[model samples]
Target: MALYDHLGAHPEDRDGVAGTRFAVWAPNAESVSVICDGNGWNPGSDELWGSSSGVWEGFIPGFGPGDRYKYAIRSRSGELLEKSDPFAFYAQHPPHTASVCWNLSGHRWEDAAWIDHRRDTDWLKAPVSVYEVHLGSWKRPKDGRRYFSYAELAEALCNHCEQYGFTHLELMPITEFPFDGSWGYQATGYFAPTSRFGTPDDFMAFVDVCHQRGIGVIIDWVPAHFPTDAHSLARFDGTCLYEHADPRQGYHPDWNTLIFNYGRDEVRRFLTASARFWIEKYHIDGLRVDAVASMLYLDYSRKAGEWVPNKYGGRENLEAIDFLKELNVELHRDFPGVLTIAEESTSWGGVSHPTYNGGLGFSLKWDMGWMNDTLRYFEREPLYRSYHQGELTFRSVYQFSENYMLPLSHDEVVHGKGSLLNKMPGDVWQKFANLRLLYAHQWLNPGKKLLFMGCELAQWTEWNHDAQLDWALEGQPYHDGVRRFLGDLNRLYKTHAALHATDCDPKGYVWISGDDAARSVLAFMRRTADHSRNLLCAFNFTPVPRPNYHLGVPVAGYYKEVLNSDADIYEGGNVGNQGGVYSEEIPSHGHKHSVEISLPPLGAVVFDALTGQAIPPRPAKAIEAKALPSNDSKRPR
Candidate 1:
């Protein structure tokens, strides 16, 4: 039986009468009672009877949805504790720690067509570009004092995603966090959607709108740890029921939160149920499992002798491994198209493999190593980039190890890390050019794409949860150029089967030139499974434009300039081949044919091969390079 159906307060017909059935798991409690406005907050007014299985359940007549309630439990030590329901479907807004009764069965869903298509689709071979968003901060009220309601946000966010050509929206954790500063990472409500936005039905409507507009929703799921709030699951019934009794085993030193006891069957069931509940009820297409590295290791963030080993005397959290495998198996088996991605940072093997094969069974793993190395390389001055050429080329060694997603996620721009645009080492124009180069590299790389919200705008300031994105900058030349460039990149990525069809297979990728460290240039070819289409990709990491740069091509024909980061529309020097290049019979870089083109400064360009007779090039003209714009004074503070 589903624990969610029986554990939380459910509107049910008990013995031919309509009422709310309240149930909780507080085994060590001497007595438990339903405390609400209906009972005047009296602990002794409406008591529940306990069962041998550590469950306390009771029914209250005339109690229904929209009622605020909490469990008042008398511990074995005679201490009365009021706690929110762990299985609540909806919660009161922060600063109000009550679980509000909600009926999730009332909303009418209109995404049947989308759901059917999703189930039959193979996402591994499809274009999966994600726009990571923080709904509360993506856009707020014009007054800047309150968050936009779910209904309001749905329309705006969907329009934005559609306009930008994003296939999915990966929202940061929205599971009813108490502190806005935590940015929903420290979740309090496991089963409830934070009421800060709107009602449960309102959230359902938000997702419905996204689906109708052809955008999938992926939420960050934080099953790694939870906060130590007094009214939460830190200590229940005067005992460490949900967490471990030992501090070293139960606590997360980094976040000062309590880790779940995965060894306990009830806790495992609870977490797995919560994972299923979101997909089953909210129609969430994916769950980005957060902080998975912390869960897989017993000695995570712990000193020697601080943690205990398992039966085999190993450091791995055996219980957590089992739980993860089980969770993935059930999620995939029950929900055919639902995706479970792991944000695991370590070199854990087969994280995206199936559980039946002794793997963790995640659908995708965030490519953190590539993100770090690429950023470190891009942050360096152009003169020093040649020495660090390995940063960009090293990905080819294990690019297909797992189903990876190239993520320039929110984690990169928080805690004084600076924004993506600001992290580039250059003046205003060079910074914008480098940022565009970085995005082009990410999209053309052999992985799926996931970019954080404000990154596309080229925002200067790091993300602040208290405020919304810098919308005013959207009209500026540089910022608007970056936005437009990203949208075009997304469109190109989606339309080209050669870019995504065999993303997880090494057969689709081939290196044309990877050892040109002196000029800091890299070139490769991406092809479809059957080699029907091929794209030549090259990047120049310096500010000096290379005119008549010879690059190798597999076949001799006309190569169309599909995308150029240095195009005038993207606020770069109009430096490129006029339109397309004809392959020469001369050999270069081990290829039978070659094309001579102008390589832009600190830019990336893609060329699509046309296998027809070579076309005559247009008459050469002196392309006037535009002057780079200076930094705007109206930057976000």
Candidate 2:
């Protein structure tokens, strides 16, 4: 039962008694208390006389809406800690003081007139190619120590993403993490967004700007574990409370964090409510659960003897699974269009299937296998040995993950992992060729897409949060052209029917032509033509320009260039396809038409349905090339 269910806050009320009410769940301690600026109670006048299922509920007579407060949690040891702000949405300070009180209602949304991406199933089904970025590091202001404001970022970042044609922005867990460098994987307060960015309204303003521009916002929410800090939920009532009392039950070895006792109703409510807070209060479009795989296993980072087992003595943590299902069901029920994504990298069965069908119920899961297989293939030194490796080990898994996001997230660009382009081996030309092939394959492969920041622009440096993306790289033809190419790709993807959701149709994407699985050269077609129409994407990964390589087209007549990744302006040698136009007659293959033509070397090309009005490939130039060393350049993965 709720304790102070009587008082309702009104905007005019300056005192907390009439202003608003706040509550926290802490089951272990003997007593719970509250502290604030205008406290008329001294732990005696204010009592959480509410029903005791471990919920500490109290009301202050004079505390108003903006009044800051902290929990005076009492422990068995009589240790009372002065805690940090828990529900602070917009906390901003130089140091000790963080997060501000952001009333979301304060924003004047000029974007109310914008079209919503929230209501349509078909729009939801569209292939969501996201760019997961940690704002601080991706692009910083010129002042060195400062960060870009929501308005500053809205124009540049949105334009950059929109230009690349990515459908969504998956922010690295923005709900405040303690360490600036932990990459936001560790979350402290589920109710408060990290004050590192800006004010509460600033974050909302960012979302509003994104929606107004037609891009979706997906936030990272951590329900699995939290930091072991004093201000955190670790010891609300001054006890080893919310988490399991047992060391193994409470701790995460790798992260050194306290795990949530999901079996507890109050704990479940805290997590489930956290999920609801964003979707309801902030209007966020989706959530990406961080490290869900860890949440499901009792022996997450432990050996046989060092772990806790379920009733069946299995490695699985079954309680966490139930909480996740109920949470998903309730969220979907409340807002049917709200999407839930999981960052599960385990062999957990049915992680992204329908909840009604007895599954963990997630709208999508990250295709870790795809990231691994694709990364491994691109990271290799260019070799004819690739043909044998062309068929990545993760393809079958891709078809089975139901709804999946093929992500090249923050995990792929940090520490020793290196930049995507730097991951490739070979001369610069060969490296770019490899990158072209990798991206082309990704588009053709069956799954939604996600790229980390600066990947499309070909940032040569590994990501560092303090620095801006290597914007100077944009001056280079290769990088600039690649950016443009990516934008075109996004446009084509959103405009196409077959490329949206993987489940739209099993036959949506069919790989045609070269099956030379070895020789390192891979040639294939991504055809999404049902009945009378189709679009074709073909790619060639060979190093030196293929002098008249025959590419069997899926349809005949004139197929125009919808996108070309290797035009000279895009930093390539103008070879083979010096504006070559195809207008040949193709024979019918069942219900589809097929045409055969020569392909340019180291090229990725997309064609519109009609071959007749198709734009001609550029003619080869006779000019001497600049920086033609295939060895010096590394392609962006």
Candidate 3:
């Protein structure tokens, strides 16, 4: 059970008296009292008795549910402080910081079937494509600036997820935060679901609806640091109870937040309990831990002379590392199907490996390098891309270092960074083409996929926390084409075994032609664990079609063109190998057989080789053998 159940306000019957039991931890306080609506918010009216362990307990008759409360403590140093309960399950909608007492039991959950399936499922081999969303901005009430309630968001969000064939929905933090601009990153209530949308039960119903629709929910959890709001956990008991006393260690430079004292037993327990509470209470499928790189290092954003080194004279924060390992161990041990993903940007070794093998024990880590390099490559003009071919191929060196999730997340489109569609360097037509190619590349690559909400719609503007997405663009032909392409890509990714089976294994990916830089083309083959099914992916980076482009394949039968980013349905030039091509016995790129293809301009084509089966060709026009001139005579064959 979580600490919230033991501490804070809970409904209880003591000696036949129906009342609420209040327990709080204020180790350094001289006196503690529950200041609530029943007591007219007076500190001395309902005083609590203290124990040796620093906990104070009391029972207030008739103060059970729907009461607003705060803990008033007189510090040992003769100072008084009023703070919200850190273990609060629901808080007053912010701008008012009182913790609300509410009963968390008796809400029925209908996700038993989903829970059972999750436990027996091996997620490593599963097709995990997450659609990252900011609930407030995903959609809003049409009448005005008022937000959509959780119940409304549940049906709308899940419907969109099902339409796009997304396997999971990764929510950008919905925890309680005072400032709307912070986008819930500076969370005040760790255990409480933000009341900005609705009540705690409303949020629970939102999650329930997702599970009913077969979409897993992943919340972005921020345990890295907290906002220094006065009413929050900043200086409870008029002392640095949750944070460190020293500014050099506790204060965060970048975000102006306070770091938690992970070394302290109570603090560790509080953080871990918060993590467990969400999984146990809300039935969340996974937790994508935010700013993990900041937690792992003591000098993350500080100068060498300004930071304090660890006891071992190293930059690594040992306590935080231990806390992470323990958190992962406990969560995985207790919740069999729950996932813990890290947004770690550094080259940290073994981030997703097992804890028993001297690793951090996370299920997955975000592939920041892949995201950066791929974006950098796509942002360059096609004429200059040949010189930067390494940008596209560099991931092969460290792709299998961790169980990676390739995320084109919201971070990339905020704070002056343009949206994904606007980041491409090209004319209007080529821009949409480049965006389609980017999505195809992400899906065809060997990793799990995560796309921020508006990228699929090809929205031109950057993400704004206060404003909703450009829903009007969905009706535009070009914008609708991108959305259609994404939906098809997602469906193909989920159904194809070769695309997701060995996403984390090296044996699943093989390079067919990675050095065709003159035309800025890339070709790779994705295979199943037993090599039973194979997918040959080819990309033409420039807006120049290449006909009679022979791609190497392991099999000799017909290879079906499963997906084409340049198809007319996707608002492209429609250049491609008609439907399927027969492989010839000409050895190319060290393969026994090869197929000639019409590679589209700034497009991606995926060919599925149905091995050991007779594949009848679909009706289509025959592709003419008109090969484009290559700078390298020794190009693949």
Kindly provide the TM-score of model 1 when superposed on the true structure, using C-alpha atoms. Answer: 0.96
| 1 against 2, candidate with superior TM-score | 1
In order, what lDDT does every prediction score? 0.92, 0.67, 0.92
Can you give the lDDT of residue 43 in candidate 1? 91
lDDT of 3 at 314: 96
Cα TM-score per model = 0.96, 0.86, 0.96
lDDT (Cα, tens digit) per residue for candidate 1, span 1-637:
7889889999988788988999999989999999999989899799999999999999998889999999998989988899899899988889888999888899999999889988988899999999999988899888877889989999998999888899999999989988888889898899998898999899999999999999999999999999988778878788999899998899999999999999999999999999999998999999999999999999998999999998999999999999999999999999988889999999999999888887899999999999999999999999999999999999999899999999999999998999999999889999999999999999999999999999989999999877899999988999988999999999999999999987887889989889999999999999998887899999999999988888888867788899999999999997988788878899999998998988899999899988855445546998999988866766876
The best candidate by TM-score is 3
Tens-digit lDDT string for candidate 2 (1-637): 2111221211234342354454555555556666555564244344454355555565555455455555566666777665554555544342443333344578776554433447455433566888888877777767777877766776777887777888788888887777777777777657666666666677778888888887788998888888887776677667666687787888898988889999988678767877888876667888989999999999998877878889998888889999999989888888766789899987677877878887899888888877887787667654554554644643653565466677888788888788888887787776666666667667656678888887887767788876778888876766766676567677877776655644334565555544544434444444453524455666665554544444455556555555666667666664433333453443433325554444566677665555444444535778886875675357665
Clashes of each: 0, 41, 0
TM-score of 2: 0.86
Spell out the clash pairs found in candidate 3.
Answer: none
- Winner by lDDT between candidate 2 and candidate 1: 1
